[model samples]
Target: MDMIAHNDSLQLYASDLYHYPSLKQPLAGLKSTKINLLFGHDEPNKKGVEDWTFSSDHRIFHEKKIPYIYFGVEDHKDYHKSTDTFQNINKSFYIDAVRLIIEAIKAYDSYLPIDSKD
Candidate 1:
């Protein structure tokens, strides 16, 4: 979700930018490469396409009829059950997922401009 927020900001700036967890930290420079939209929910009962096109910056990204990647993980009894514990989490997979998002942000940040506007 944080990555999504940063991407939203990128849509406005359209230039190199980094969003740190804390304002006190230095921002890492980014290079905008491609738009990677992760659509889908982890919950079994919640699955659908997320439409960012209705957003104000809809015109920023090119539209296409092709399909996009959707993070569809199979839901189990522990999907959202209270029994879901950190010990049961897949650490490696989670780390890789986060790394991918970071890489995408870093790549896209380079071409973003702070003064970009509608």
Candidate 2:
């Protein structure tokens, strides 16, 4: 979709783009899930490495050495079929997830800008 291009446009000026929610299914009431990032040594429990590795636009940013984050979740059984609908979303989880992401971003920002993290 146009979202990828929109993100690409931010590559130059934005400090970083933390990718999230390219969800195949809406994240709703699910409570057991967590946001994942590129796994790094010594942070095994906090970071997760590689999903959408071969298939997502995030790979383009990775190749370009842009500051970005890949926060992904486990795919549900509906993965990518037409059956993925708003009706199937876990509404409460979606709200909570958004809040979690916002808070995490705030925490990350408090330390340093993304481009300077490396």
Candidate 3:
């Protein structure tokens, strides 16, 4: 459900480059899912993805070195604008994005170990 306002676009970025392989493996099986793996220059800077620190909740996990996936739409025309309203959202794209996230969570839950200490 990340960045629901924009559309069906999803990007996966990691704080540590080494974490991507594990994060990517499960997502790879999602048929027709167009998630992109961001790295190097494509990866988020210290302030966070798109320099919008509050854009994602995964930052805490990222700081802890826990692998995570970010499901978000790339910035759009209505971003941070007065036009950024519910009516402006692409409904079909939003639905598909949510479905994709659900599938991704199911896959990760099955493969990842639960950290009871957390």
State which candidate has the highest TM-score: 3
Model 2, span 5-72: residue lDDT tens: 11111121111232332221122322324432222121223357323443466668767765465444
Model 2 lDDT at residue 60 = 83
The digit string of per-residue lDDT tens for model 3 on 1-118 reads: 3265365455533223344556666766765355453432224444454443234576677667675555555677887788888888876666665666678679888878899999
Model 2 reaches what TM-score against the true structure?
0.51
Report backbone clashes per prediction. 17, 7, 0
- Can you write out model 1's per-residue Cα lDDT over 6-108, one digit (the tens) per residue? 2211221221111112211122333323333333232233348233332333323324422222222334455556656666655554454455556645544
Off by over 4 Å in 3: 8-19, 32-56, 114-118
Residue pair clashes in candidate 2: 28-90, 28-91, 28-93, 28-94, 29-90, 29-93, 39-48
Global local distance difference test of model 2 = 0.39
Compare the candidates by lDDT and give the number of the best one.
Answer: 3
Q: Which ten residues in a row are the worst by lDDT in model 2?
A: 6-15
TM-score of 1: 0.36
RMSD of 1: 13.5
Q: Residue 41 of model 2: what lDDT?
A: 21
Q: How does each model score on TM-score?
A: 0.36, 0.51, 0.65
